[model samples]
Target: MAKLFLLLFTLLNSSFLFSQENTLGNEYCQIQLISTEKSPSVNPPIKNLDKEQVTLLEIPAGKSRLRLNCRLDEQGVFTFGNDEILDVSWEALEVKLVPLAASSPSFLLPTGTFSIDFVFLTHHNYKQNFVWEPIVTFLNASLLNNITMGVFYGLCLTLILYVFFMGRVVGDTRFQFYSLYVFCAATFFLLQEGQLNIFLQQQSFLLSHQFYLLFAGFTVFTAIVFIVRLTDLNTTWPKLTRYGLEFGAVVVLLMSVLMLFLNHNELSALLGSAMARVTLLLMLGILTLVSIQAYRNVQSAKLVLLSLVLMVIAMVFRTVLHDVNPFLQRYSLIIAFAVEAFMLAVAVSERIKSIQTDKILAESQANTDALCNVLNRRGWDKKVNEILSEQKIKGGVICLLYIDLDNFKQINDKWGHDTGDKVLKVVSDIIRNQLRSIDSIGRVGGDEFVALGIFYDRTEAENLVIRIQKRLQAVSLHIDKQKTVEVSASVGHVIYEEPPKGAEVMLSQADQSMYQIKRASKQG
Candidate 1:
């Protein structure tokens, strides 16, 4: 949070640098090559420096290039390079551009020439290797870049953590791939900015370009996988897109891994770069094609298509059109990443919501009896167990009503199966109507049903049973033009003041009570 505020504060103070005259924010020191000895790479072989900055690929093994007279605003200027001398007469310094890699490895080496033949030059070139840019100018130029990098990394990290937290709630599949994708992308961009130095003993990730390619490829691979899962591409375009997407992701990933292991000499490095670029192009083509097709039918995919297009534009600014606009080149990828991460995060939440909804509907369907319009045995046990498990309801009176039709098989035999089904439906409706809304009913058998309820006492429980029985007895459900059958049940209930462990014990006691009622009725 503090870092985020710092970034904002830096942006707000952008005009401060230009107002300071002592800063020399836009000025370059005047330099002149006075001596005629000049390296071939140096443009003007002699005299005054003009027209643009100088960059050297290499300086000859041991030969000195030239003598330079650099004039500052009386503060003076000097080159950060190898062992050289300054002639005070003309303020002239020898120009010998020996980069660190080309210098001696010995720490004991004398900076002075081996004119003292008794001693070996064994020490590193400890001289400073800094460019001639004012500190304020560097900060001013890099202000936007610093802000962009901070926000980009900050947003990516926050989203990753958010997704992981959600993963714990919903499940790992919801956020794992998406978070990994973001992580790899963040790493790739960090490498691109060349900010991650000092790893592998001062070798910047910029030097190991393979890691750059590696992470870049991984970002694409995980992104494709995330999209495939998010849009449910397999179930929809199984054969059409499945092979193409998987193949592309796998090939790109494989090539990226391969680049890391290869011995990258000049030719190898060239080939590896070419391979990485080609794989990227191939994967992007595949991604674009798949996303466009998915967008037409899948509503969720519209966001995905937009993210991909925006990402492509960001990449163009970061790479191909970098010289077109400095702002776009520096911050375009960061903007793209921020937008893409947000869109993906939303997509993931939607997926979680959809999964939960589907699960609920599936459970409902599985535990319901269509014919009776009531809970099936599974759902009955579930509801009863829930009621019994609650200490509050169990402390009062929980009545488990076991209902069995007296002549259900007889009705089926005499009036045909349709009449029997209608009778059961009618009986379920009558029982439901008699009981309170909090009560639950289920069809446990062909003609056996169970219901659960809470009441004030035994009197209230008996009153409910009486109402159900009376309603069932009074039902004159017509079977056909020839006859009508009375919809009735033998209802036996067991009231639990202190609920038992589970549902089955209460059900067994109620079933026994019902059998006794049925036996006495048969005798009468």
Candidate 2:
């Protein structure tokens, strides 16, 4: 706990990041777990209010309804049935809550504790809503809450669509998981807003708040999978860590299924202490992984970890860490979710760049020569053709050189293949070093090499050929402490002002020129 606080303190001081959705009671509203049982209260007490139990008249047996002992500090009217529970969820009210109904009923009672059974709506008015109906899940407290929720929902939706389409364009499933998480996260928060009851008041699943919880389970699942995929955690994590995560996932799935059958209290237990602890541990575990990856300088991890930490902190303070400021509780998730969306977008962009980089590297490796570290025949031909095409467009000439090492086989026989191999390496280095970096070279055959370069004209082309020949002739190989052999090459050159049919024809002419040079050397 100390370490967590220390880390959070340091990070919070330095940077800011992402957000998510939730329930505790969920985020935007608290569903009053209304019950008719003559049993012990299942509701955790809202802070700053005294507790005293009162029984209502209407019941199957001597069953009683739980009445909250409360008083409002500031005078204000509270509505029922339309958007009420959330804004006042943090505010301890001073009125006895009873099962009654009216079209967005308002409570404008004077402040007092443990006194009056405030008349909310007439008993005759509750006739249609006495059984099997969601009494009041939402309350409209203020427009600020409304605006806050609107902004939160909008940000979540925008990020969701952005990441989803990016995944499609890039053809990477990692982005898809992230996008799903964004949506799950947003929808989970929406569940807490009690808007679901507005649309599905008749549906038991929504009224029971099980559907809200089901999405909570989904949020956990998606968050887990998203991190796993993003960090490649399965491969990177130790076996025990991996198993723990897997186990957590199974727990979430089981819990989700349980939400379907459990009553409000049972579901609350499922989402309450035990589940919150499990979720906290899961979040900490993921944070640990992101930390390790960030340590290794994994860029995506670094980018996401910054934002993810804020979200975890917001969730912890909102859920498990009690007695916090009401203001922090209200806006923490909002800030966290918005910033998290931004970071996720940043992380997704980095992933796309990484994919592109890997692809280009793969293509380069496919076309490269293993021994020479330059282009092989296939790569050389393609590059030379591109250069030639550019030269044709720009109205310039290109030089092609066909170089054949003189008496290369004789040198191999006298000096052994080891020296011959060394000679080949040195020869390739010499030719490559003498040419422009953009020029193309390839080992065409045994002791045969080719090169192509852009030139101002035939004069510049011929001059470069002379320089290459001189550089090659200046080489000497030492076979022993006292023994040496000379290295030389016969060069054939072609300068093309007009575009050739292809690289093959240019190479053929250069080869013919080289053979002529060899024949002349023999006569001389």
Candidate 3:
């Protein structure tokens, strides 16, 4: 009984203090008129900055009972200037203070009771304190809300566009996935920040709360999945990352459903807020580590780091300063999230480029002959055209050669094609060993071969041919009857200032020259 009495006494004292603070004994205007411009990106009335005076309410001096003074700054923020701390330059103004009562009385001062229509009468209970009111039309609340929503819309759109462009350019699966996830997150954030649920024609408490619960839950889950994929964490720490993601998803999903059934509204709200903060912190830690690891080793890892930094900054503004100024707080998060999305998109693009490079290398190796480890005919043709196109600007000369084994058929008929193949392999090896790195060789036919090189003069080209022939002679062969088999080549060469109109033209020229060499050797 004593404890209950003490608690009651304490409550009474607190109530007394609150009542004293809210008292309005003598009817005097304690006016707090605020005039501020909508920050940006919305449908807002253009504030006439030049208008230094505000005609709040017109009334005859003799009929006015109370007065309060205020002034507008350059940015249009109004400050109370009736007190001693008069920071703003006050402009003399008249205003009407109407009462909402039926009794009317007259006095020396403008003290006659006036009547006005009463609107919403909000009351705050002691236990559940209400800090804000539903905006009144007289306060330009709609305009401010519109401006705030507009900024979020523009920011989200920008982020989506950036993510798409970066994903396309990078061509990486992870980056594309990152872009997609960011786009979804931005869309969800835009909806939540805009408070659009309040404006729905058929708004219901259940539907509104459910939408927010699902949207937030899915956003958190999606962000986690995207980060894991983007950082290749699943590959690096497959077991842990995979299990954690799955566990988190399941927990959030269950909580989402539970919130719908919960009787404790405040408890549900607190839990949701706590979970959101925890998820955000965990994501930040994981992303930070991944980004740092990437930056330490990979050339393209900076994009991830940049994205992480941007996200952290955005969350700071959103989680920390949400109540300061709706415009600044909201825009800061929007811009930061958009920037982070762009960076992640860049990271994804780099991954795509790496994949493409690997593909090209694999293709090149595939088209090469394993025996000689040189390009086969197909490879040669592809590389030659590509090289030609690349060097066209430099305007260089090229020498093409066709070399045929003089008695290659006889060797194969006497000894098997296996021996012949060995001989061909040896010859290909020796030719390759003697040629410069810039030169290319291809086995175009059974006994015919093609060589390509950039040359300054015919002397240099002929010298290369002589070197190949000498090396071929030095290479020994094994036959059934003899320890050695003689091998020689009939060589033909052609020079082109530019690539031939057709490959056939170059081949014909080289073939004719090879026949001429054969005839000359026969005559000798």
Candidate 4:
């Protein structure tokens, strides 16, 4: 009976040694046993094994399983260790942590000191000799870390969705895919880091892992898509790297399922990490190459090159560090997202600007007469109404002038239309040279022209019309050798202080006065 009590005491003591109030509270000796192997000690040599409290159990050589774990403290001291009894072979080690306390609603385990042996795996042959210890687990993170990651997740998702939705209307495929890729990368990091578990009532085994894998795959795919698009790689490199990315995507998709179901997590993780690094490098390198080519290849790609430079710098800092402070991580994604989104926005804006410019150019061309470079008759009529509408409310005088060239068709009949065209051009240039920038001129008849000007006074308006007629009369044209013709114009004008009697009324008043003067000149 006494011996039995002693054995019980021993059992309690052993349990006490392994258990603690909190792993975090006992920071000095916090150890996580991730994996173990029961095999021959001399199979594959292990490195960085601390020689204390580590037990070895053996089964055979080169057949041991690897167990891995991470230990952390408030001081930010983090260390990873494995408890495979034998040396590790080249057989890869994969560790998948469920962290039930993080995902389970009723996850209250204990509030006091305790310890539990976390056994990852054992040799298939050594199952009978030793029982695997249950895992030690806890869920403790600084509120700041949790909140930082949470905010980042929300912000990134928002920006991504905004871009995609905007892109739908804007018809920019590059923005659409870029947003998708950024969303995938942001969400995957959140899930993998266990930052998004707060929202889930209960974590679905398949959903958690599978969704993570899906996002990771999509992130890689979208990155490749962006590279191909940004570089126009099909026309540029167009070689093995392009084909390899396509093939890699397929392989990654298939293996992601297998990795989840078959518990080939190590293989999956290693490949995933490797693929991530490779994708980042390839994308950045391709972008750099494209930027160099852009300098010489196209002048418009300068912005594209600048944007790529920013992305390359951001990615290099992101991937190299094993762990980043939560605040920095959150900040990094925000800044990077802003930069990328801004770049895309600029590209979209440039396209919109170009379209608007083209419309303006077309409208200008449509309003102009090709031969005289004056407003077309229809354009002048339209503009007159627009100006009158404004002047009606604002209270201003609009001056209209009618001018007829004397014997102009006789010159066309005698000198040929080519020279007649030259004379017309010369006359149009003279009229344009005499008017204020505010005045508008139009050719309203075969050899007649009309001028419209807005003025605050009738005196300035009359002076402008007289100056124009005098300028035209002084014009001299050489019709042929020793046959130079002196040209003169009959001018008539009217000013409307209020709304016009009618557009046709004002026009006819000016026209009839000009014809009367021409008739008087011919009779004289």
RMSD, candidate 2, Å: 14.8
> What tens-digit string does per-residue lDDT give for candidate 3 at 209-246?
45456556666676677777766677777876767764
Per-residue alpha-carbon lDDT of model 2 for 301-391, expressed as tens digits?
8877988888988876654452455456545776887888788788888888888889889888877776666677778778877987798
Model 4: ten consecutive residues of lowest lDDT: 77-86
On TM-score, the candidate that comes out on top is 1
Query: Which structure among the candidates has the greatest lDDT?
Result: 2
TM-score of 1: 0.71
Looking at model 4, residue 218 earns an lDDT score of: 72
Error of 1 at 196 (Å): 3.1
- Score residue 94 of candidate 2 by CA lDDT: 39
Of candidate 2, the 10-residue stretch with the lowest lDDT total is: 123-132
- Over the stretch 380-473, how does candidate 1's per-residue lDDT look in tens digits? 8888877866646446678888899988888899888988888888788877887788889999998999988877677887788777766655
Residue ranges of candidate 1 with Cα displaced over 4 Å:
1-26, 29-134, 140-148, 164-175, 198-201, 204-207, 235-243, 261-266, 392-394, 455-460, 478-484
lDDT of 2: 0.65
* lDDT of predicted model 1: 0.63
**By the TM-score metric, which is better: model 3 or model 4?**
4
Taken over the whole model, the C-alpha lDDT of each candidate is: 0.63, 0.65, 0.56, 0.58
> Rank by lDDT, descending?
2, 1, 4, 3
User: Per-residue alpha-carbon lDDT of model 4 for 422-476, expressed as tens digits?
Assistant: 7777787888888999888888777788888888878888888889878976678
